[model samples]
Target chain A: MWERNPVIFLLLATAVIMVGTIVTMVLPFAYVNTERDAIASVVPYSALELAGRDVYIKEGCNNCHTQTVRPLVAEVIRYGDYSKSGEFVHDRPHLWGSRRTGPDLARIGGNYPDQWHYDHMREPAAMAPGTNMPPYDFLDNRDVDPELTRRKMEVLGFPYSDEEIQALAGKTDMDAMVAYLQKLGSDIPWREQQRVTLVGELVNPFAGDPAAIVEGRELYERNCAACHGSGLSGGFAADLTALNYPEEIFFRIIHDGIQPLRMPGFATLGNERLWKIVSYMDSEQVAP
Target chain B: MERPAYNYDIVKHFVHWSILWGAVSVLVGVVISFQLVMPQLNFGEYLSYGRLRPVHTNAGIFGFAVGGFFALFYYMVQRLCRVPIWSNGLARFQLWLFNIVIVLSAVTLLLGFSQSKEYHEMEWPIDILITVLWVAFTINILMTIFKRREAQMYISLWFMMAALIGVAVLFVVNGLSVPVTLFKSYSAFAGTNDANVQWWYGHNAVAMVLTVPPLAVFYYFLPKSTGVPIYSHRLGIVAFWSLIFMYLWTGAHHLLWTPIPDWVQTLAMAFSIMLIAPSWGSVINGYLSMNGQWHQMRDNYLVKFFILAITFYGLQTLQGPLQAVRSFSGFIHYTEWVPGHVHMGTMGWITLLICGAFYYLAPRLYGRELYSIPLANLHFWLVLMGQLIYSVSMWIAGVVQASMWHSLNDDGSLTYTFMESVLAMYPYWWIRGLGGVVYLLGIGVFVYNIAMTARGAQASPGAAAQA
Candidate 1:
């Protein structure tokens, strides 16, 4: 019975399987376990962003959207700079998905305003025609559970204060999702930030002029309001009312929009109408 | 020697339940395939593609494939060893545990309680249930092997041992995590490390679960079906050892061209290329075993499945290694090509072989001849057409998608935006979804054949024949 023991066969098989396991898995883990490379710019999610990420995970967005940008020449051009390994250090269960049914979201942060994400999620087909993403309008009706968010942050080992955790209370999944989307890749200065060609005379030519404001409203409604929202808040574009910027920055952006993000330039309107729209935007409330 | 009264009832029930699960998995697959094209098909929260995609995978892998593994392993172990199952009680317990875990897995996944690791998505509580079930299975099978009357173990036994040991190790090591709530947990590793560990588990889940068990079933049933012993048991042993050795290293291939360390990717790619040899080793063994039995392909419907399944196994291994190559991976890593590759293995190689196994076992267990060979033939044609259509269309889609993504204008700006790349997939998605419908129809025929055999057949293979 002892001759050519099956235990020996079992042992041999176990040994063979372990050799690869140790080499591929165990060694790298031991050596690189200490020196992690979370890039200098990367940081942990705040309370509401973490809550949004939880909603993202719960909805299984990773099934369709990948978070990592590959280091390919074309890919870099398509979705901004390639994703860095260090940027994902705070990711516990890493959402670097294997498929790309949708676009990569590694650099989605600061790419659009809060309102764009909200409208896009609520009605994806209306926002982008010829796409098949199911609408997520139900998120507006549901609020984040603060206790659960607190427990999740603790579980993920993220640092959060009570105040930060409390900020999630009464916030809808839409709000949290928007916050997370806007926070995503904010660490990096992507194309949208770098492309603004600031020239002199930043002030709007029609600043505080009532007649220009009225004319600007018509141009803004015709050209920008569909994307920028009728309230000058936002839709498919950034929330213009949130930030304060001079007219030259606005002039350049309006005349030469960020094409890669699919934002079109309205240089067709000419300088006068463009500045009138800028004046109209400048006169509007910057903060809700 | 008197027969040990090999238990057929356990094998019978396991086969029956597995076929049901397999049907559920296929039905869900068809629905989700359409959901990708016509997003309107995605109904409510629980029925959407995101929630049900995991349901499709889990039901297929665990509910269908793993259930099939249990059934086939029990059947093969007893006959190959010339001994009855070591503990009928353990086997009975395992049958229930196996099913409950699958049900709980489907429900939990549909509820969106996922840890989000591909292939290993079940959270901590369900994970513990799987561990208990695995432990019970391991103990029973090992005990059966230990007490076998036969001295020289068959090659299927070798493959079986490798699967048993390999899955236990892979599942446990990868499942290491710190649980926050009963329903949730965080991987012990993070970011790059988490990715490295996941594919190590993820890809090897293919090796141990998908490849090995089906190979074990194939080796057992092929010779049984063809009425000829395998050409070389020695080749099977060598292949089994080498195949087990190499497969574990190739998991990192999934991480190729990504953020993980470069050397790991190279090592994974090399091992992946080398893996074709051992995978083909069994394929060659199966082909050469048919040396005198070439006429069986005409007379025997079973031979059609075995030959084609092994042929697919050959093709799948070849495709897998080519995909692992750096340039090829860069082009099609996240494209539809990967899904196409995976389904060829699952639908073509694994499911075909196991369906053949079930057909072979159903008659013997039910004590009756198969209800209809024509329906079996119908299933064979339908599934083959379905798999071919699915894989071929997706392969075309992957190439087209990759080209469009890589396409650049002469001035060097992107020629197509991400949305444009998505728009190009519509035609192929429709074709792929149609293919899924064909595959599901084939599985429906399969389930009907097996179910009718249970109800229609009265003649039984006695306890003493093979026993």
Candidate 2:
């Protein structure tokens, strides 16, 4: 049966592939609620966020940055809570990349404000030192095509109203990209509440101590220079030298860490070390 | 009775184009390697690493590897069946369509129309083109096989058939997507399901396109080059069946620690380890076939490539299963180590074997001798050195990076920031770029030798007689 007729061989080959597809591809869909309305976290992307997704796909960001955080402890600590299947139910052809030349961006939304991503994308080296990433300044110049984006989304059954689509007009690619990034993992429960609670009454412990300033400089170099740049100007991450944050908010940010932004909480460094690092950053800001 | 004149013309066409595409793929790969260390090499919008990286992968897998397979498959099927391709016109049409599809893929990817699925990046329209093209090629090969003069199929025929059917199934299933625009589309599968399906297609694409086809070439050409048949046909059949059975179950191993069910991951891990047996089965067959004629390793340049190629295949199979283990994957899943493992298979095993096949075919196809055996030897050593440098440096860099990322202070604070790990990789990236340059230089020598051979250069008297 196997040797004589080629038909039987082809049938066997087809049968194996069918079995594989049924188990790996079809079976998973049955378990997960893929419809946007069925899952709370799986909201349809806003018009601006949708446009940014197009930019993300166009730029092939997923090549270096993955969107799925595995269930491993290190991965969870490094990239927020592990990714839930329902959170990505609306994502078409999910952005779970195979490699991580850069860090995972699963929970990148709201990690940094708009300006941080802007400065980082324009000149990665300006924010983080020793980065291999290239600048995407072209995004600033390119305008987003809301109509095309909307039409594309409509075809894919994304719930976008005409008014919402129209509001996306005149936005640059960078604007849309930032909007999209700021929306990632935004629906995770307690993310906003945690940030609010941490910042409510916190204050920098070593706001202007001279000795702590010196110590803070050392801490920044050892702990922050790789992503934030040695000059605190920027490379792979945001420019700490440029941003002006109130003492209380800064302390809260440092202690709690911005989970979505891939910044680990250094609370284990203790209040003293954390204060010193904050003081050091403040000293750099004040210096000529 | 005169056998129908086998279509060597179509074979010639595919061979020429395949060599051209292979060179393009290698050149782009070297550029991207350099871009990792020196970001200034990125030419702004169109050529950034983000955009061009996909081009490099698509060109390497679809253009170079698949193109070479078409050329060789056409050459082998005709001779094995003792008949011309079932449809001469259909073969001619496929030749042009193949070039058009590849060129379009490169252009569209650079213009930023990708689905973002690795290995299946081309958007909906191109996916449709690919489906049509694959079906045509499948029909041409299978129809020819069915009308063969030979009743019993050889092992190469088995592999060729598997590739024809295997690729068709994998491509069409994974290519399922909802078209959002002429240029854009979304995967029909959502989230975890999409990840699972993509890797299943991705890993098996490597198996069918890179693994089985090359093994088919090795089985056919190794014996022909050395004037010896493979050691055991029965052993070859066992290995083939076991490999096909085990390979599909192993794709989930790529998702080891992910949210995919633990049982699935463990199943993948077990199957991946079992796979080494069948993989080494072919490797052992290649080694034993060389029992009496081991001296060919020194005398014949082709033997050097085949033996080395199979050796790398053996090492790659072993390392792949080891990486699938849960603990090992925890250390290396997203590091430079994965690429290091991958390049050995592409550069060492597949590329070397294909180059050997081309070298064996060039003289007969062009009716002339290779321009220089010394040059071929130089090419061999250069690529071997280059591949070792590339894989070794990355492996070391990966281990260091993984250790640093997992390091913790006595107080349970992280010892190093992410930036420190990125900083440490600079020197290794520079070494990798250097390795790429050496490999590119080797490709230059290879292209030159083939070009010279095709231009009707004089063959040495002894070499001319062999052809």
Write down the lDDT of every candidate, Cα atoms only: 0.84, 0.83
CA RMSD of each candidate after superposition: 6.2, 4.2
Q: Write the per-residue lDDT of candidate 1 for residues A248-281, one digit (tens) a residue.
A: 7777788667645746555434467778988787
TM for every model, in the order presented, reads 0.89, 0.91
What lDDT tens digits, residue by residue, belong to model 2 across residues A117-188? 888788988666678889999999999887888887887677878888788778999999899988888778
The candidate maximizing lDDT is 1
lDDT of 1 at B89: 96
Give the top-scoring candidate (DockQ): 2
What TM-score did chain B of candidate 2 earn? 0.97
Model 2 compared with the native: what TM-score? 0.91
In model 2, the runs with Cα more than 4 Å from the true position are A34-39, A191-215, A218-253, A257-288, B1-4, B457-467
Score candidate 2 by lDDT: 0.83
DockQ of candidate 1 (2 decimals): 0.37
What CAPRI class is candidate 1? acceptable
